[model samples]
Target: MLLPLPAQAAALDGSQLSLLWGVPFAGILLSIAIWPLIAPMVWHHHFGKIAAAWALAFVLPFTVVYGLSATAHGLVHALVAEYIPFILLLTALFTVSGGIYIRGNLHGSPLLNTGILAAGAMLASFMGTTGASMLLIRPLIRANDNRKHNVHVIVFFIFIVSNIGGSLTPLGDPPLFLGFLKGVTFFWTAGHIIWDTLFLVGTLLVIFYLLDRFLYAKEGVQRQDDPTPDTVKFGFNGGRNFVLLAAIIALVLMSGLWRSGISFDIYGTELTLQALVRDIGLIAVIIASLVITPYSVHEDNQFGWEPMKEVAKLFAGIFLTIIPVIAMLQAGTNGPFGAVVRAVTNADGSPNPAMYFWATGLLSSFLDNAPTYLVFFNTAGGDAVHLMGPMASTLAAISAGAVFMGANTYIGNAPNLMVKAIAEDRGVKMPSFFGYMAWSAGILLPLFVVVTLLFFR
Candidate 1:
């Protein structure tokens, strides 16, 4: 059910601006009216601050560029809804995976901990970065619970498990799936696997080596007596929720399969199966995930709906307040932005993949990565160039950038907020909004610069 990047190739033709602005705005208004019921969750300390910051980030720029740009309203909604189920699956994965149950000794040799980290990274590639992160984060915290200098461990977890490890497959991340739908062969993405995996493994080996060297020296300074022998059993008080998560993923796959068929003829050009999937899958997944997952999951595990409610409050504020501004940009702002994109042509007047990679990635860090990826993909139609190899390669790089670097911040990807919420649910105090950026700016930005120099460049 993965969508192709080329399937998203539609120009920024403005229509339905009123409805685009209105729906998200109304969703926001309704959310606020329900705030009293959502108070306990939305008002939590961690999310409350994040909600405020998210509001400011979306609002300030929206106000400044309200009438100066234009966008494709349908594209934005299509992109948003397309990945909503994936987001819920990630949320469900973290919520049920014993959220943060960890058992182990921090006194283990540095070599042993590194081994465990590598295992976590491998799991990330299969189950997804967010799922791996959520499942392992609590255990990582618990492993280092007895130690004071554990921040480095957490940082490296984000680096490998959350970002780098998922470079090989569509199941690993949404952006890679974009490439899959775009006619790139299923295993084509695995071409980058060697470099990406090496980079992650090498980086973690070095970082964790240095960290353990320092932290080990400090061990004696605050050492405590070892606990009683044979007491390492860990328990999940909320272990029965795996069924809920399974149901969510099943529904997501079902919706994806179902929507892959809904299509129509347009101007004598029949829509491809890929296009049909992207367009219809979005609506199908959103409706199904929202209505079905919540009800089914609620039956068994009745956690105070705190996490989802918090996300709803913040995202509602974001979608509502920025609609008019986004609508205006979509209506008439194509010349400057589109010119930059449209002007960079191949020797034969085709699109430039490197430019697409950088542009989509840079904006994706701020705007929704999904739409940003679609905008660039649609603009660079296959007909723009008759040659196949270069075009496909270019699209691959763009897809990687959008999906991989999106882990750089709490808001860069939808799963990011979900990870943070689940982390908090396990009692791990994740960084503040800007504090998270500080983490990304240090680790992920450097990694991205390396990727730019090595691959995208």
Candidate 2:
């Protein structure tokens, strides 16, 4: 049961429950524990049957811990506290291990692949970063079809599909939803449209130039004796799933109409109209997609379930290992500043949303973006003066910054790792955990620096 904030805080302070931090930290340690078992397999792309293995390694732990926490008396507070972070983690896992194609196809030119890739990246923000990444990864690998250095292609895809692509609207990313929840005008986030579009175009063009150069370098290695692989065509396979994908989008939009908030009905019954609407809507979309997509999958000779299996495997690990960590962080938060060491306000009494953005976003990348957004949002709201427009806009920017930038690392955004897993399945080599960060530090960090100037300054 979801307890209100005041009730939650009262429960925590009243119960002498200071050890709650252990739960989330334990979850992190657990993730590290299984890295050896799963990381090697993913690196070599031995993903033929990784789903079952991942289930045992990751999901089992998450389930047991979550269940234990759910019933352990005071533990309920920690579990509910970490709910948003849990969802973000799940979303990242699903996105990274997307259910779409992952193995390279027999045919498609590099230029053609890049074009398809760009379109897919743009589409990812809408279908969710995971959905788009899963659908396109296999085709992307096939399009690059024969490039020896396919890792570069997959890395750029992470930058576009997993990160920058989700900046368009609230539907594009969860951080944007944080803004929406705070009474941010939906159209207000559209103000980011121009900057978001520019970044997307720039990122794609940069990828194209780099990919073309890499592909060109391999021209000399071709031999006439080498057999040409069979070519694959776009919109030729699983094209019908696109319609189901649209249905999912519709369901998500409808969920917005019914949000859970503090309200009561007649007879003092707690009527959670919003929660019911969203929960049911999400269930409908997932069910419809699963049912509808299989019908056309075999007609295109694309019925192997590698991508979906990979998602199940990797996410199971993520879900378990991070639960304790999210729980602890939830307990650690005391208020606006809470236990976080950061500036919360300026000399003139304005909420320091920029600092909140950076601090929250950096932690969100490593920890959990959803709660990280909330922690900072809560802190910003602590200032009595921040209840209005400019302050609200600042809070929105901070929320957006945290959610959007969380995609900067593989583990940052919910969909990132899913994209990586899908890319690996398709025979594209994604970077190691830390190796990917180097790219983000170089490219994404610079972009955020510009954002700091353009938006916050």
Candidate 3:
């Protein structure tokens, strides 16, 4: 559910919004970043409360300052409109994909892991990052469970499948889908960003293979306590779920294509008929997947709702606290964040596409990429025709930046964290937030620098 801003209401006047309004948003993000490292036990226990406190820190004072109606408008807009739709979509994907158990006793050799990652990267463009990651991660994890040095495989999986792999189409990732809704053609992203995707994704895959080959040699082959050691035949356990995955894709596509114009007004938020239909369809998909999937399939997959629950709780607060920050960004040059806008622009006022790439990427690395892309998209004049025409480079930069750089951190995109949580739950000791950043800084940043020169420049 997206809150439709009336033509009259440009959301909030950026000039009137102060830097003060943005502190809680910063607080929540910082807590998400630093707290998990210094206080893992407390963070795991009371993260939801931390998220809620930050949300209330903004909402309570905002109500006092702007009046109850304005506060209600803001909260309802973030909660009922954006957050619910986000969580439900993730839940539906996680639930359905978890039922799909890719059963096989394939060795977790360098070649096998690379092949699985490559397959997942291709599947991501059709089934979405969340769907593709969930479907393949379990098998990948199981394959590597017997190995000593396997965390690198998960890291590269995040780099490729969870992030870069989703660049080809709107269904692959949220930022691209937001662009689609803003009137960019369905194939526009793939047409413009395919080269970037190919280069970055291909480079990452090659790097992973060489690195894994080195690590495999260093660790040596040890099958002493092998879980599924013998080379059993490969087969999928829940084939029917493929149909459900296709239906999810079709339903998402329908939401974008259908334009009935019917809408409901909740507080100040407006929910469109198509969006309402999409959410309802997603709920139906979740229910159907649960009912149709056998209990054993889930048990074998080791499926649980903890990952989904964590994402929902954390992002619920993130969406709310982000409201003011986005509003401030919308304020542009007159607002507190004016310098950021200035940095991305030339002295003559045309957008620097390269700067747009880094700026969008950096923000998307921490903040939600979908909204970050929307902000920069609108900032670059918000006209699909112009963007696809003379401003084509600008739009492409924003699009690529949002999608590609999300792999920079676990919290960068929704599915990145989901993959991390799921991997940790399955007993893989994933890196801490900063530790993960070390991996990206070493492996991904150098690749991005090359990308900046080849594409954005």
Highest lDDT against the true fold, candidate: 3
Model 1 — which ten-residue stretch has the worst lDDT? 66-75
Quick one: RMSD of model 2? Answer: 7.2
Model 3 scores worst on lDDT over the 10 consecutive residues at 1-10
RMSD (CA, Å), each prediction: 8.8, 7.2, 3.4
Clashing pairs in 1: 4-181, 4-182, 9-378, 10-378, 69-329, 69-333, 70-329, 70-330, 70-333, 71-330
Clashes of 1: 10
Using all chains and alpha carbons, the TM-scores for the candidates as numbered come to: 0.61, 0.68, 0.88
Name the TM-score of candidate 1. Answer: 0.61
Q: What local lDDT does model 1 show for residue 139?
A: 53
Q: List ranges where model 1 is wrong by over 4 Å.
A: 1-109, 178-186, 192-194, 221-230, 234-336, 340-353, 382-389, 414-439
Candidate 1, 1-457: lDDT as tens digits: 3233333323333343333333443344334334423573654455455545545554455445442222233325423533333344444444544232334334434675687678777766555665566556655555555555555666566666776676666556656554444444445566744475567467766778777867867675333543323255654433334444455444434433444553433322234454444445444433443443444333423334555555555554554344443334334224223354454446566666667666767766755565455555555542213213556656666666676666676556655665566556645566876788897788677777776677756
Tell me the spans in candidate 3 whose CA falls farther than 4 Å from its real position: 1-10, 146-148, 177-185, 214-227, 231-233, 265-268, 366-390, 414-435
Candidate 3 structure quality by residue, lDDT tens digits, 31-114: 876786689899989999999999899989988877777777777887766677767777877888887988777778899999
Q: Each candidate: what lDDT?
A: 0.53, 0.52, 0.83
Worst 10 residues of 2 by lDDT: 6-15
lDDT of model 3, residue 174:
78
